[model samples]
Target: MRRFAAAFAAMLATCPGLVHAAQPCLTAAEASSLTAYALPSAITGTAKRCVPNLGTNAFLPTGGAELAARYAVRKHQNWPAAKAAFLKMGAKDESSAFLANMPDPSLQQMLDALIEGMVAQQIPLDRCAEIDRVVGLLAPLPAQNTAELLAVMFGLAGKTGKAKNDLFSICES
Candidate 1:
């Protein structure tokens, strides 16, 4: 939901001149790969942030940890494609050069931290229960499927004119 959309919007908003760029958008696969790479961080961050409100017995504190670990197992495998999508986000802008030049380790760390921070901040205390339920319901999915599902959701959002901007777009399949 709303938290996911807000986090995505916040990320796109950070890149000035990124919306409606002439640069090509990411394919669904690429978006999925990137999402897989970041999903673990997002889960951990959200769990950490919401644990106070949700309590130690909530889905976030218990099941969420296992879910995050499951996603983390695929992160390294997902990194290459994710990195490409990350850099390509601002490909038509001046920041592209900087992004291209950054060492992979540094870039990886930066993105992980950025994603973790964005999700943690975007989720509100009141929504913790809803998020917990959603995470619980989603826990059955394998990591890749979960990532792909999110990519599709975001792609649909982009199609509806909610996700595309000067800086970001999901390519049409």
Candidate 2:
């Protein structure tokens, strides 16, 4: 029975669902999402996680995710210091180094995730129903050619597809 228990523990260690919360504040998946080519190849796996205090907002930087966003961008220039800065910014304990090594663009995605995560934890994300509306309307348009996307955001008229969905279309005229 003792041997079986030990095997079970070992098995549990490799189980991601169990590890996601029990192991540390951050997850391996979160770590891998960060990629910084500037760092030495060997330092690509050092990261840790942090737990949030309930009923309070902790992750959102004072100026609306600027610190975290900048930290993400810093990977494009320097990463070691940036990682340290991230630590200083209340990231607490980091586990995987993968996040520190991700490129700047990926960091944008990371920041978005972090912001969205904090917001979701703090309030109902459905409050921002417009994002869904935007996605649904924009889905048919070519994302690669962001002219339509930008036009809508900036209230400037641009390209029109064959079937313009008024519910989705942004007419700037």
TM-score on alpha carbons, each prediction? 0.85, 0.22
Candidate 1: stretches off by over 4 Å: 15-24, 161-168
| Cα lDDT of model 2 by residue, 1-173, tens digit | 11111222233233233323322221221222222211111111101111221112322212223433333343444433334433222322343344445674675455434433333333223322332233234334332222223323222211334322211122222
Clash counts per candidate, in order, are 7, 17
Report lDDT per candidate: 0.77, 0.29
- lDDT tens readout by residue for model 1, 1-173: 55765675576557565433464588888989988998898898788788889877789888888899889998889999988887766546667677668898887887788778888888988989989988888889999998998877777766676554332457755
Q: Which candidate is the best by lDDT?
A: 1
The residue-level lDDT of candidate 1 at 124 comes to: 89
